[model samples]
Target: MHQAPDILSLARKAPVMFNELELLQYREQQIPGSVQYTIHRYRRQSQFEVDDMGMLVYHRVEKNSKENYLELRFCISGNTYCRQKEIECDNCRFSLSNSCEQKSPSVDVLSFLFSPTHLSQFINGGKMKSMPDEIVHFRHASSFSKTLTLCGKTRTVLEALLNHNYSGSMENIFLNAQMQMLLLYSLECMIGEKEEMAFTCKFLANESDREKIEKAREILLQHIGEPITIKELSRKVAINECYLKKGFKELYGTTVFDFYQSQRMEHARYLLYEKGLSVTEVSMMLGYSSISHFSTAFKKHTGIKPCELLLR
Candidate 1:
């Protein structure tokens, strides 16, 4: 466990080591014996374009002992583009000036590195037998990785982690709470409950159909300002309306309309609290017919009116 600090300490020295990445922000917290975690936000340097980016973790626990842990990586925003269709983005390199018409993509990534001891705390007694082997035996293995789909609940927690007004000790408390939530959601997604597994839409069992459902969720997020109906969403993703609706709930833990409304309200809170936008302005921007209507929806979703959030 002492190596945990040594592993995270590398984050502070990343700027000198990785020229292609600019570390924008870094925060680490240790909850005595409970857990130790680090949150790092980094921006990819435009001059260096990479098709794949990764972080390598290595440390010695004792004279002849070593340990390994899983890494969770999330791309908060940005897209890579290459002007020359013939060449891939990884092969294309740009100078510091970025003279090309299309500048290299600037990506923002939020990454989490957790200590193994902290991760073990989640497994309680007999429940450990039911947990995935990847988690149950996380320490002994040198390499184990799993890519998780970002459900609406996971995305909401990530959004709060990135955007929040708390500071000092309060900030620490808020972040730790959010990180725990992320862990819970990730585990649930990985080790689904028996009921949920049995009730999962049959159509979603196909890889192609699952991708379509994921694409539909992406479309909903993209059109937050002006929401599209389920029919339009289904047509865009080439999925049947009924399948799309049921599959969305099964995969994301929420109905299509509820997910869309939740996203809309979250964005509205950001605009009102962070952007200092008037309630009326936010309502119009979100495509509401009237401020009163927007207020009611916002209140229903957030338990507080748009104007009230602004005051905070």
Candidate 2:
């Protein structure tokens, strides 16, 4: 495996100028099968208030039998507010100098670089024609890039990668598994777009209605702990309940109830395994009325009870 560039080097190459850039975390490993991957978490803040910023990463792999590879990048952005409102200074939030209570906008980026040989193993038993372009073209093109939608599933995996408690070998195992999942979700999002375009609901043809449906989905995510009714969701987004349901299913590839339940269960599993929270605590945090009810619902979604998962 070749050495990849560090986060600071990549940040310096970005198009937008940032007042401050910090590399919060970085992890890299080479597995037994010659698979090498790296994770970079960065916090960036700009002084001049820009609408958008973009980064460009350029790398040249060492000459070898394997010349092609794939790169996956995920970015989550949010604002960080300071606790104290009175004290304020220029560049206080962006700089590490003064200890002031303030919140500023920050962007976190996670990137995964996969080797060609590692990816090729998946197609080793089959013909190249049967494989997807993302796989087949890895060996054909020098470099290519595609913008994929950051769906809910993809966001969940990215969040897990950002916040985890594993270390050493356990960390390596967890990262490798999550990287594969990111790849799977990316491919699925790409393929699902094609299918969606072929059979999109006519109701979504209107841009305003589509926005309303998207807003409804966001509301559903916000209230995962305490789910809202379909009528309430429609009212919040100011769209008809029937249109919201049909448009949501058409756009997101799942019903509202199923999506909400799946998100809740996934969060439950995260709280149990990662946070080490007790089943009862997680059950209550998720607004479950009783342990047995939570257990039954968890088992229905995950094929195992919460207690069983905790025991693992």
Candidate 3:
């Protein structure tokens, strides 16, 4: 029987870049233990890299040094560890977790790991606190989740990055700016979550509360096609309407209705491009009242009309 390689052993050989590095190449490899990861190093200065992984995960990792940096990762597909120390994906699309030596097998994710100093300057003009220091702990504390879950704007930036899936530095300059936007949007998400915690309440550390929040988000997404209010969603999730509104915003970084609309447009794009559905069909399937309304919403979210995507 062939033995699979352990997580650490594979990570040791997970491609290392030393000194100033400039390489824009994509590499995919599967270790003996069925550990498959595709890595691409895009920018040298920022040390930008995107990793798309597969299941076969590591729950508890051996401790190791994690340099101070901000990691912005979007869950393109498949589940990854987020709230629980155990390996699981919960209900998260974009997650901003502590990028440390100990990592997870978060399949189908786009990650950007850059120095905290470089990001701190641009993120709110260095006014933001919680900048990762050289000696930072990766464990969760107080009311913070292991990874901050974000929806809407952050996920949109990630989907845009995925569109430029070519393997090279052809548009390094433009991609760099987009990467900056990723950080900015993520910063906005984290700041809003923090404000909710610090100003609004304390003892917000109940594991059960986290579950209810996740369930509320799931219910909202499940009913994206149909119009559902916060009160209705709260009732379905067995949580209070006020907590549902505030907690959903705090955790996912968007209001209930905003997240629903964003998700509906995203699903519509998938149907139009992948499933090859017509604009009207897609809109109707999504429960939109009129084709014009759907077109307007799609263009507003994607910066282009449904018809335009087909042309390209």
Candidate 4:
């Protein structure tokens, strides 16, 4: 692998500018096992040069370094290590307590390795709190299923681009589409752990106040299509009507009825956009007895008629 300089030479050709000296300084501290590889225009797909096991290995940071990257890693053949604050995803640790094996050797972990600039685009100015001095780890986790997940079709499109297998506007289209797919995939994985934790904590909070809020959420989730009243909703979640109204907003940041409406609208959006369901069909599915009522609510919430949005 050291004999191959095609892509490596391309990377070297783009001399690391003076302004990127900080990144260079950080890169110098990488672990002994780490190596940097680049993919530019090469000729053969098979010869695009992966690790011995066919993984595209780019060791971007030192093992002990505190730098956190908006990173995507796949454990393809062996156990790997990763960490970020109090959160831990350890396969061996998780498996010692339980007896299940991970489904695949190659498992994808993303979102944590993203650069500060990339994250700031979505999070405003808040990305730097978790800064260059924080040791982010992504150790193997037992729960990582061997699903055929791709970070973006970009992994595939990137492979194509690196191999010089295609050309013209089609190449540009593939790259753009793949990049978007990869970005979405990275975002999804990045939030997966945090979202799961928040959900679990909210649903399982020992405090009565939080439980009541969760129950209120459950009621909304269960009866999204029903013309449910605050009074009836309070009864279902086992809370007083007044507390249901006020306590729910305090915990969830939204009124109980507002949450319920949001749930219904979200379901309607998924049906219309993802499942290709008809507006009337979705309206009926959600328990709305009348198409006009569903349409009115949908339009009121989304600012566009369901029929018009459906065409989009």
Candidate 5:
């Protein structure tokens, strides 16, 4: 199984490369501000290709030459826009055949990229009878909240895979199993729309519910530094408070309040461990108003006081 890098130790290994020119270009165009960590740097004119599955991370990808193996790109943290065909600007797609393709007006995002072989293996005997044009159509349209929910789940699995580095450990196997799940999910969303299949429809309904709960979670994340109430979350998502609470708990396997608190504590842990922020500073930043309350909560969540964690 994979373990996340000791971020503090890795920080000392080498600072991540940042592209100032890219940042300026995006900023000048009024694009959404995005902070990037260059997890892998491709050397100029590199041409090596391998068939085996490998894990990699990149900032932005562009296809300058004829494509080799089919590429799958999944967004782990942020949003991306791409078309079926290549365009000159960022978020464009092109077709080698016919030389005519549509510029992607939006992004196609998932957290994991699967090679053609991998995808073929998934369908068993290379039969994708269920997913024809609809697969691309649904992905491009961003229609069906079910699709987005699956994308988020794919991201989670990808995160696990990257952290584990394809090890043969039990955790690695579990991650791979989850990846298989994401594949089935995408397949279901694609073909399920075309047919009235009972199982597929059932899965789609479940996915839709999960998507709603995720929206609620996103709202909570946006307000992590401030106190967020269930009513507030329900109002923001335009769902009834009672249903929102029930759905949030069922989808996320935790109550909305519990999940919200976990997110805040996790954010605080990142600040303390990664940014080396002082306990008082973190407490204030997270809107505790009182350091004593912050410490109590922190200790309850992590089984260690904020100050003690900082010492470690």
Candidate 6:
């Protein structure tokens, strides 16, 4: 007798790769602004060729290429994993593929490519006074690579496109505005990162407080299934409630509740898409009594509807 395999277990163990099939659906859009970004969207399956000679291939065929531009990748939804080579600006070919050991249904990635000249123009045009020294140092350095976390407002800007999902001149205009906003927010985050590093280097005295806040963060994650008040969390960590609230934001750049809720939705996304959980099931698991409320929260966190993800 054959038994049905556990799809959820398979999902957690499989790798999500961007095979040639994914890239075949690539559509390029004229990016807005003087910086001249080129956006490539992969919407459907790959278009890889199968050799009629009957060659047995078990893995995705590797493709090599060189890049002369800066690539900004936002894993908006689905599998949040990719395999990318180290940034080599000298036109050297290297592996460019992504795979995650998780059963992923679909993925939506927004890529913005920029030439070095255009990058300089963007910085100068946007008033580079606020950019951090890391950028400045990289401007003169031989090689550099950076990974930045997108803040809530930046993510919201990306999500708002859901309300105006269309394909036309209006779409271009709206996307242009959103791109400009994302770029500005990116610079702002860099500045904030620099300020944080400076403060950390200067204030060795606040180290203990920083550790306590981190401990509180772990407790919040462990008890995500159940809601906990600020007072309760602070008591567990032996920190004052007020200090806990303030330090939570000061350390992580978001309120405690916001952070906790955001984490929950990100987890919810994985469960709904990768684990193949139904909307009602996900809502109940997340402690939402109403599916409408769960849908709203999911959209808020991911910029699209729960049903939309399921459809994809």
**1-312 per-residue lDDT for model 2 (tens digits):** 222223332334322312245655466667655446555444555542322111212122336545556666655665333333235455453464345544444556556766765666666564455215435335332222344667777777877876565778887788778878877777776566645665357877665677677667667767878858998988898988888888889876689898788778877987987789999999999998899999998899878889888776
Off by over 4 Å in 3: 1-24, 40-199
Residue-level lDDT of model 3, residues 81-200, one tens digit each, is 333333433323234344433333332434454543353443343332362221122222111222445557766665565445443544454456666776566555555664566524
Q: Taking the candidates one at a time, how many backbone clashes does each contain?
A: 0, 4, 2, 18, 11, 9
Please report how far candidate 3 places residue 191 from its true position, in Å: 18
For model 4 the TM-score comes to 0.36
> Scored by Cα lDDT, where does model 2 land?
0.62
Where is model 2 more than 4 Å wrong at Cα?
A: 1-14, 18-20, 25-35, 44-65, 79-105, 129-142, 194-312
Clashes of 4: 18
**Model 5 lDDT per residue over 1-312, tens place:** 111122212222322222211221111111112111123212211222211112222111123212112222232222222223122432232223334343112111223444333433433444334433323222221111221223455555555544342434554456556656655555554454436533322332555554566667766877878898887777876777877877766554578887677668878988988899999899999999899999999888778899987876
The Cα local distance difference test for each model comes to 0.62, 0.62, 0.51, 0.44, 0.47, 0.53
152-257: candidate 6 lDDT, tens digit per residue: 9877875664334456777778776776677667667655765666343222236566657767877777665677889999999888888888788866668999
Candidates' TM-scores?
A: 0.44, 0.43, 0.45, 0.36, 0.43, 0.40
Once model 4 is optimally superposed onto the true structure by TM-score, how far is the C-alpha of residue 285 displaced, in angstroms?
Answer: 1.4
- Weakest 10 consecutive residues, lDDT, candidate 3? 53-62
Superior by lDDT: candidate 1 or candidate 5: 1
Ordered list by lDDT, greatest first = 2, 1, 6, 3, 5, 4
> Candidate 3, TM-score vs. the true structure?
0.45
RMSD of 1: 20.8
